[model samples]
Target: MTRTHVSLQQNFAGIVLTQGDPGYDDAREIFNAMIDRRPAVIAQCRTVEDVKAALAYGQREGLDIAVRSGGHSVAGASVIDGGLVVDLRLMNEVSVDTDARTATVAGGATWADVDRACQPHGLATVGGRVSSTGVAGLTLGGGSGWFERKFGLASDALISVDLVTADGREVTASAEENPDLFWALHGGGGNFGVATRFVFALQPLPVTAFALLLWLPETARTLLRTYRDMVDRGLPLDLGGGMAYLTGPPLPFVPDELQGRRLIGMIATYAGSEAEMRSAIAPLLALNPVASMIAELPYTEIQSALDDPPGFRNYWSAQHLAALSDEAIDVFIAQGEAMLVPSPSQHLILPWGGAVADHAENWPQPHRSAAWVVHPFGLWEDPADDDYVISWARNAVAGLQPYSTGAVYLNFIGNEGEDRIVSGFGRDNYDRLTRVKAEYDPANVFRLNHNIKPWTP
Candidate 1:
């Protein structure tokens, strides 16, 4: 091993890996199979001190640095070629203060860790749609989840964040301390610093219900219209979910013939019992579903119900819409029809508003004001089909451009361009975030994410 590699291992409190070392290949594996990178060093951090040591060694050696938790970035921002990766998987932990109605989660912890801890206490905060998603990455990008319509984004539930800056200085951001940095953390992503821990305000959630209803692909247009009309008429804040066109999963409720067949589906989550949930979604229920699964299960069970298996080549994009016109609905259906069937892809229309819009002005994600979001999530196994899948996802968003709010949710998309990054946060909020970036990460040491460059005079 080189002297530089030895030095980093000496200083770090956790394991370090180089090429050919045991577990090096496994450590580099991430959610998106399309991303294949070989970093020079991988630091498996176990503590905040290890994070500092890893950052110092990477900077001292002039190596590009990437921070990884769940390694779920479809853009593969968490790994770099011939650089250093600060892997935080060993740091996963969650501490709950039930009396305070809060959860302090380690940066490396997945939403599963948070949900499992909070579920026992009948408490929870908003979290990622996929249980395997990292807490820091999702919250930093303005977290979206099933509970958002009721409790707002996961970032909105943050009480404070403990971070280690680029220069290895430790600091805390909250409403009472470093408030500017705290404000920027709402949706600024990983541009500012490496978050070590997050304290989130939790709400009591004694009961929860989930329902998955599916119909033939031919019913998409009618189903879409009925879904839109129901949202337009004002659904309860306690109701949350989305509509999708996807290959049906091999579940008990799904017919054998339809298991791998393309179908139109609707998923609903209610913060109350199954009876209340049935009442809330009576309109869509009246449409007659071919397959259905409705149950009052633990919140953790519902969080992982839709978890997609990893190692699939993945590509996704989204468009926020102020309104879903009938013409736009036709475009959505057309795009869904064109998707590669017998795959894990989904063309989805998720509802917003409710608590999402109620807290719109409080954060940088102005897209929260959008009434609907069209997300094309592409996941397939064959590399030969890459072009076809990617084109379908892009075209799905393009067709709805006329009704788009011109803003985006960064977490829902891969690296599109710098312009899309700026649009993720509005111009004014982006400007403000740049100033904050200038203060905490002026040298731009953490630029792997949807970057916010430091302000220049």
Candidate 2:
């Protein structure tokens, strides 16, 4: 290594890794196995100051910069080839104030970290479904979770975000400070800057009930229709979950005949007791699911119950719908049949309403007004199946376009295109976000995420 490289490392409080360094390759690895980027340097940032130093160094060196948090960007935006990555994983810390009912989470923290910390206090804000998802990436990009319909999307709970801007400035965006930027941060992805910390408004969630019921794929039609009917009839705000088509596992609840089979599953969570959940799930129970499990558990336990193991090649996409017509249900089920079995893929139809629709106008996320979200989470181990799996997700989204709202959740997709990105925020919000981008990042230094180009006067 050059003397300059050694000197640069000595000037920082965090660790710096160059190519061939002991943890370099592992540090560059993200959630998707399909991404194989090799950054020239990775600054393992520990503090806001460390983040600032890394940003300044990357800009001064004219290196492409990617900020790494939970490293869960499906597009692999957290890492760049032959560039610099400000790795924030080491900065993970969660501090909860029980009195104020709020949580201040470090940039690199995962949903698991926040949930665990807040669970003890009988408090939690909405977070990503997967426990390992980065708090900053999810919240800044518009987080949707199991309880989103009850409280709101993850971004909706955000009180403020501390960020390191393109110009190496430490700034905090909140309702009372830089309000325009704060609005843009909602459903804005990571376009504006590198978020270092986030403050979230917590809710009283001392108890929650969880359930998982499985049936043969043939029951998908009945299940989807029942779920649609329930939503139409005004399901309780406390209930939130999705119907998924996944590879069934060999759990005790599963019949020996159904284990390792492609099955239709309903995972429901209620913001109440198991008895309350039982009453809420009666209609579904009447459908006679082949296997089931239900219990009142800690919110943290439910957060990680469905965690997909790492090291799987992943491809995912979503379509927001204006309504779930009968035709749409059939099409959704048909696509589920195309899903790769003996794998960890999830063909999901998630209800979107209640708080999601009520608070849609308060943020930049355009898809919030939609009645439903169709997500195809594709995860498999074989590289040979990449094209097929990606195509399956793409086709699933395509089939639902007739009923689409034309807006999508950015977090649920990869690098689709500029058009999809614009659709995510809609034209008006996109214009506003661009103006904010122009003010904070005129040069577009943070363009690795779903980019919003600076507005030119």
Candidate 3:
């Protein structure tokens, strides 16, 4: 029942929660524990009309507006202190359009919602590796997952978006309709408007494949060689996976001898028949894993394998590379040796070539030229060891600057600042994005994100 864009502040019809409201603080917070903001008013939008009223109200009242879906932006772009936050957390609705082979996802829905909805039908759309991640932020920012190697990404699979413009009018952007907006949203991050619902193409998800993991004992060289070959000839399109260098944890399952030692682990996914899956991963399995945990499980279970519990302690950082060169392997080993800790934190080099790399020029993504995504993530619950956690993250991220391609995945970025956002789009991609943002949001109403500056007139 939502109509096109029109200023409707005078007829605003929604809950405008002020600072004194009991739920105000909860409304402005995001998944990242580090971010803390106090929006002057948080609008709990139950419908598109509620969103319109909130936007129109913000514009007319001379206040900035921030739209929050999952509230998971690493840049913490979803909310602002003393501004207006249009919260769509209550709008999580999943509808499967089986005939169209598409799923209509509400803005507030997370990957968990989508995955749970589609898994029963043996169909899945591209989603983030983390199930709790919101569909809106991840999708708009270019969703990547274990399946990305075979299925492309969430952004490329976008079919349409129902959005509310600056003045509160609703519109739909799609490839055949608003092509420019479509391209921008594909990887440009949020700029056009508040997308309330997203339609995505879905594909069949396999019941299981061979998931493999072998620990590397200071074996960076051998691991890198195997990685290069794996990426060159991926396990299987059905078997989207990666092998990683790791520092062993003291989990009861890990032999006490290898615990707390530098080891390599292969986090693999074989999306095919068991026999084929086992054969596809045979090369890496042949590498002699200290301990192996490979099995034929359901797709939904594997997708949720690394699901971190809520209220988890998380610290993540990443770099982009055009190629994982031999010289780079030296750097990887040297840095891993220095930065590796006795804890569970793992350093990862996720292969980035294949369909992810075979893009035409000017695809609107700055990291397009990059060949792989390297993420070194840490997790711990001890508040007393905050220094140790921060130190580990900094050392690992700092040493890899030389081999990195400029820019990064917005999802993997930390509190590095506005500068990192500019870097995420690459110098050139940022320029074009700024222009696109200016075309639609001239006043910068959507400034509370990995912001694209309003274009200079």
Measured against the true structure, the TM-scores of the candidates, in listed sequence, are: 0.99, 0.99, 0.88
Q: Write the per-residue lDDT of candidate 1 for residues 1-457, one digit (tens) a residue.
A: 5777999888568999999999999999899999999999999999999999999999999999999988999999999999999998899999999889989999899999999999999999999889999998999999999989999999999999999998999999999999999999999998988899999999999899999999998998899999899889998999989999989899998999999999999988989999999999998889999999999989999899889878899999999999989999999999999989889999889999988999889989989999999999999999999999999999998889999999999999998999999899999999999999999999999998899999999
The candidate, 1 or 2, that scores higher on lDDT is 1
- Which 10 residues in a row give candidate 3 its minimum summed lDDT? 1-10
Descending-lDDT candidate ranking: 1, 2, 3
What local distance difference test score does each model get? 0.93, 0.91, 0.73
Clashing pairs in 1: none
Backbone clashes per model, in order? 0, 0, 6
Alpha-carbon runs more than 4 Å astray in model 1: none
405-451 in candidate 2: lDDT tens per residue?
99999999998999999999999999999999999999999999999
User: Which candidate do you rate higher for lDDT, 1 or 3?
Assistant: 1
Ranking by TM-score: 1, 2, 3
Model 3's TM-score against the true structure: 0.88
Q: For candidate 2, which ten residues in a row score worst on lDDT?
A: 1-10
